[model samples]
Target: MPHHPAPEETLPVIALNGPTASGKSTLAVDVALHLAAHGQPAEIVNADSMLVYRGMDIGTAKPTQAERRGVRHHLVDVLDVTEVATVADFQDRARTAIADCRRRGVVPVLVGGSALYQRAILDVFEFPGTDAAVRARWEARLADEGPEALHAELARRSPAAGAEILPGNGRRLVRALEVIDLTGSHAATLPAWTYAIPGVRAWGLELPRDVMDARIAERVDAMWEAGFVDEVRRLEAAGLRRGRTAAVAIGYAQVLRFLAGEITQDEARADTVRRTKRFARRQLGWFRRDDRIAWLAAGDPGAAATIAHDALGPDALTTDAPQQRCGGGEQAHGQRR
Candidate 1:
């Protein structure tokens, strides 16, 4: 019997993205295992924003070293909780990891729920430069006047930026206003930013809202059982406070409320579920707006792996394969509204 040829292989930078509690991590791990079984081991790169911060484990749902199952994972737990990590930083780090994987003949698998981080890694988005003094000024204003007032000011200065920014998203709102103050140009008209890196095929996962909510609740319970409260307490003991990005993370924030005695354990659990659901919704909304993401259903990991393999092909496993170049390539992949 003549053997059928495998699908024409192309070197792939597989980006597996989805909303919170959408099983992206598990799916990616399964896909990596499948590829390894097929003699093409994948290097899993972390793309979730909160996962980048060190000392944030249980709440972030970071995969344990054992769970990695010998697959090489990169770009996770690389930054201090106090240090700020922008999308540009993620793009740079992820590109380096992908390039390194390619050099070593490993498939690059970008996996996580952070839509902006995923887009920054795979697509072009120019982030305006920041001035510490200006940022400090804005931070002061944010502290003094609150997010609502700052949002109102942003609406007046750059409605385009304001419209895209959620009122509660203080980090982005401050960045947008700071850009306007520094560059004298609207945040929307900045030059396109591209990662000086090769291309990769990206895939995203989609789950039903109700199903995702249920999963979030279950995951929150698991976290609590796994000592998520102690994890938050440890961070607090180490002087990590609310209003910081790490503290704002879904499970962490809810736990902090519980620690403060502002909410009961039941309320904390319920709030974690609610906040995670909202975050997941935002992530879905962000990724769904991008057409380049080949959306896969939240089903069997094997099925997801099959879809990813079918999309990326065997060529993606080849080392230093010549990448196909295209114009507006950066814009073509991750243009989320």
Candidate 2:
């Protein structure tokens, strides 16, 4: 039997995003149920870059099966510790999941702290193809001239990209320069906040700075108690150190340093808290740049339902739910918004 695509009106996607520990997962489940009550069957597609790695449960704060509460989830635990997850790779898979859900007449809710990954999936952005030799050349330049000089060159070539990326961030600087070399301009290589995916609505959860800081501290302490160190030890034995992307995940990196005896466990935990707070701020900064996402307070219990209902419209609960489809197109780079 040939599968027909669902009507556009019936397919609405809800993207619930926020900083780490801002309760996006829990809120996503709640919103799914709320939509289900309106006859909208929904599934969650994972967007957090770190959560895709299998065996990275506690540290990544991956939702437990029980926590999922019968709602189907996609993209979680889909990668091994040794595999690298690029934004383009994630965007491809996430779009597939969203399309499949719509074909089945189900709503797709994307939930995560990775604003770039989410944008890559939801926005009309395309990553440029890479040339390994060119990349290597820039990397070599980075090594010899240091990031400052390379960053200065990038600033001269593409000031917009340079302003957005910190000079100390060599990898991004290299990628920006690479894109500029490939396309004559770097700013055009990044995604605009415009939506390419129809009927896609995004919401951001907000909390006071102090509250988020305290939450991060508490969460780090809980992870320590939940045996995050032990989890990393097991993954380390499974070649985690060689996984370019996985090795540098927030908690895992701190734990790896602790294991190397470079830092005490207490220092590692403290550093994790510090780094996480900074990361959360960065997440906020990235999402804030996009004007489309509606912001809601983190403490509000009804916020998810409100956002979901708004995205689906008043008729959503009473009418047969329609499915939404996500389409991909070519264009640009997509981190930090």
Candidate 3:
């Protein structure tokens, strides 16, 4: 049987995904502008979890208003630091934004680094059911012995799922265990690639490992210079430590440790860089598992235009940028955006 598309599902969405410092955000905006200039208006719908929180700008490397070049963006700064958001929650919000854009005859651009979160939004996925008793039991263990303990158990139950989730994410760990308990298996493991919505095209940015390492180091250095510590301090005043998810974010956690006097500022910076590098590797591995993404080598001068053209068609751009930005490469794009 032929699959007939729904009205909203027929609209196009451009997904620029990749590891940190691979420039997904910048590419997303550039694509939006290119699409608009070429007669297909587009808007950016942020797919990064951290970017959703207000007052997390510096550490998250969120694009400033000027950096966005006046492109309308959805899901940025939608939550306070004290609030928590689940994958299901984000999936709902992102789809709503995409639908709104389509309803108005505009293309929706999906941008972010977290592979799992991106999959939640774009893939045909249904989160496993949760049992209150099972959840409470795991939550109790989480509170008693800490997240790492449960993470170990999760690894035993589902190695791929465990590897995808961070050890410090107690809430996520508990949820995974609960889902496992209810269904007798964890569905967080990467499933066969399939998009929930039709006509969603994804592109990934690929950089040489050495270059990626240098970029991450430079980004961390810039963040500290840009007052990353100060940003965390400000959020701390606003109850950042109280938020389970935000409190443990890569750079935020290190800064929080420094703030608590558990480490020197230098130590925090070093730890942030090291941890971010490790995280970038994980992000790369996760995205690589999704064969649907077309990976582009980094710094292909005309790749952005090529992707814009792919989304908007031959009448897509006025510029003479080359049509091939990424082809015959490895992995999906963007790290923990």
Best by lDDT: 3
Q: What are the Cα lDDT values of the candidates? A: 0.73, 0.81, 0.84
- Consecutive 10-residue window with the lowest summed lDDT within model 2: 325-334
Stretches of model 2 off by over 4 angstroms after superposition = 1-5, 138-174, 316-337
CA displacement after TM-score superposition, residue 135 of candidate 2 (Å)? 2.4
> Model 1 compared with the native: what TM-score?
0.82
CA shift of 91, model 2, Å: 0.7
Q: Encode model 1's per-residue lDDT on 119-167: one tens digit a residue.
A: 6777656676779999899989998988889999999988876766667
lDDT of 2 at 318: 29
Whichever of 2 and 3 has more lDDT, that candidate is: 3
Worst 10 residues of 1 by lDDT: 320-329
Candidate 3 versus the native: TM-score? 0.91
lDDT at 313 for candidate 1? 56
Score every model by TM-score.
Answer: 0.82, 0.84, 0.91
Give one digit per residue, the lDDT tens place, for model 3 in 219-298: 99999899888999999999999987788788999999999999999999998999889888899888988777888876
TM-score order of candidates, top first = 3, 2, 1
Rank list by lDDT: 3, 2, 1
